[model samples]
Each structure stands twice: as C-alpha cells, then as structure tokens.
Target: MATAKTRQKILQTFLDLLSEHPYEDVSLPMIAAAAKVKLSDMRSAFASKLQLVAAFTEKIDTAVLDGVDEDMGDQPPRDRLFDVLMTRIDVLAAHKEAVRALHVAARHDPALALDFNRLEVRSQKWMLIAAGIDVSGVKATIVAQGLAVAFARVVGVWLEEDDEGMPRTMARLDKELDKGGSFMKRLNGLERAAKGVRSLLKRISDRPARRRPRADEDDGEPDLSDKAPAGA
Candidate 1:
C-alpha cells in the first residue's frame, strides 16, 4: 500500500479507537496494531495522538469542501451557508461517535479545545468561500469565526440527531445562522459608524485651527475698566 494509504488507515484506526476508548488511554501501538501497520511505519503517520485528530479534521474538511454545490450561486447567503454546512454535517455523520468522544475530551481540556478550534476556524473559512460568500479582510475573518462557533454548536445538535432526516438539527442550524446574520449586521453597522467617526475626525484635523490672538490686533472697543466713568 502507498504511504498515504497507510497513514490514512492509522488516522481512521485512531478515530475508531477514540470512539471506544478514552483519549488519554489510547496508545499509538494500539492504533498501529489495529491499522495492521508496523509501529515503525505508523510513527511516520503521526507522532502524537493530537496530530492524528488534526489530520482527521483536515480530511473531513477537504471532503466537505469538495462536495460544494456550484448551483447555489443564486441563493441567498444564508441558504448557501445552510447547504454547505449540511454537507459538512453529512460528512461528519459517519464519525458521530468519534466526534462525541472528542467533544467529551475537549470539555475537559481547554488547551486541546483551543487548538481544535484553530483548525475548525480554518475549515469554516473554506466553507464560507465554498458557499460563495466573501472571505476577505476583517469582515471575512469575523464571519468565518462566527460560522466556526455556530457550526460547532450545530454539530453538537447533530451528534444526537437520531431522526436520520435531522429536522431538529436543521432547525438549530437555521436559528444559529439567523443569530450570526444579526450579529454580522450589527458588526457592519459598527463598521459604518467607525468609518463615519474617522471621516469626521479627519475633517476636523484637516481644518486649519484658528490662530490665537496675541497682544496685538485688538478690536475698537474702549478700555472700560479705566474709562467706565468717562460718560458720568
């Protein structure tokens, strides 16, 4: 078998083990044995357990992105995102138990959770792009991050969605997407407000300041302090 095939097998075996065993107890040797690859060759696939999980996420992300529907061009942004996210859920459905196991691990491991979210955000950026949404600049970053968080929540619902058709999961995703849309609208409003403030500040700064009057150039008003009784 090719090296790539062997490596993929190791990853799959690790996830399979993860589904059945605790992450802290799963061993590389176990993965190697289960994958039917020698420990020596398995070392070439993953140096640590976390690396195996990262590779799994990358593989799933690639699969979801490859399945993007170009026919969603005319749909609204939310619909486009809905379709792509559903496709992602489809790809994840097979690994539900493995994912549930990881979620349990993450809840107890802040460092691992943060690291995993880093990868998840990257995946969400591709999802945004695949959905025909803009993934550029600060706005793109904000949208992608919001989608990452929302997607995680949606996946949590998906893991328990025994209905096969996933109606409940779809409703949860729709609600989350609507929440994200509202947030994006607010963010855009803030951006617009910020731009307006910046323009106003620039205009103020560009206008020449009025020169302070020196001891010279007084008006024609009389010195009332000394001459106030002149008329009297």
Candidate 2:
C-alpha cells in the first residue's frame, strides 16, 4: 500500500548507499538518511534490512530481465538463452558490490536463498519456454537448476576478476558451451520429449473405451471352495 513516490525515494536511497558502502556495513539509519526518509518510514516499508536487500536484488533482476525480453524478438533459441545469460552477467558485473552483498546474504538467510532460487528458476524456465521447450518434467528441473548454478559461478568469476582476466573467463564459458552439448539444446530436447509423452498419454486417455462382457454373461461360475475341501 506504499505510494509510488515513497517507493522510488527508498530505492534511490538504497542505490546511493550501495555505491558508497559494502552490504554488510550498511544500516537502516544510514539508508534512511541517504533516502531522506525517517528510519521508521523505511522500517514500515521493509520489515528488516534483509528484506531491503532482497528488494534491491529483485529490482536488479527485473531490470536485467526486462532488457533481455525487450531485445529477444525472433532470435533463435540458443542465441536467446546465451544472450540473456550474458546480459545478466554484464549487469551483475556492473553492480559487483550489490551482487556480492546478495551472495553473502544468501549464505546466512534461508529466505533470501529461497527467494533468489525461485527468481532464477522462473527466469530459466521462461527462457526455455520461449524457446518452445516444456519445463514440466523432473529432468527439465534438474537441468535448469544445473545450468543456473553454472551460470552463477561463471558470473561470480567474472565479477571477481580484473579487465585482464575478463576475456579468458568469457572464453572459458564459450569453450565449455561449444565443446559439450549446448545446455540450451539439452533443455529444449527434454522439454520436447516431456511434451510428446504428455501428448501421447492424453491421446490414449481421450480414446473411447472398449466394451467388455459382463461376469453374468459367462456360462457358469466355478466352485473352487468345494473342490479344495474335497482334496483332503
């Protein structure tokens, strides 16, 4: 129920403070002062510091996804996945401090970890679905999680390195993607297979049932209990 203006002010304050300090060193009072809002107001909007951090992280994720989605028109499936992931890496690299804070907070905050994972999984699924892949099966989920973790590690390395190592780091990812089967292709294949299976099952289930003869139509019922007692 917060006003747009108030939300904008809070976000601006957070960005300003983030540029000047590490995540661990930031406090509510400092953020309020930077945002020109009262500490109570900040607290009212975000229940805790961790929630503020999550909000900031979500804002960054949204911006990156928006940029990728805007530019993904008519691109091939592989290219779209690669482009989106690289764009996200670039965004995180540009906001290294903020990214670092979120990484650190994720280690100590279970809720943050769950939220972050959910966002990541959703984005990956969206990319796969856009590429005409089904994201319903267990295998698809595992593959998506694996790709996300790998991409995250790559981004982490890119953020931690200097200009000299950036090319080498990117080259490594390119080589990895090219040398082995493309992660995007695997995801798409799994999705297609899942869809095919689902379609087959649906078709089978939708077919008309065949009539069978009733038990009463038989000539007679066997008397097995009488025969067994006579065996003694």
Q: Identify the leading candidate in terms of lDDT.
A: 1
- Give residue 39's error in model 2 in angstroms: 3.1
Give lDDT tens digits, candidate 2, residues 54-119: 566566567666676646667765566666666666666666766666676666878767777766
**How far in Å is the alpha carbon of 108 misplaced in model 1?**
1.9
Query: Would you list the clashing residue pairs of candidate 1?
Result: none
RMSD of 1: 3.6
lDDT of all predictions, in order shown? Answer: 0.86, 0.66
Residue 196 lDDT in model 1?
100
What are the models' TM-scores?
0.83, 0.63
Q: Give the number of the best model, judged by TM-score.
A: 1
Cα misplacement distance, residue 222 of candidate 1 (Å) = 16
- C-alpha RMSD values across all candidates: 3.6, 6.0
Candidate 1's residue-wise lDDT over 160-226, tens digit each?
7799899999999999999998998899899999999999999999999998767666756666777
Q: What count of clashes does model 1 give?
A: 0
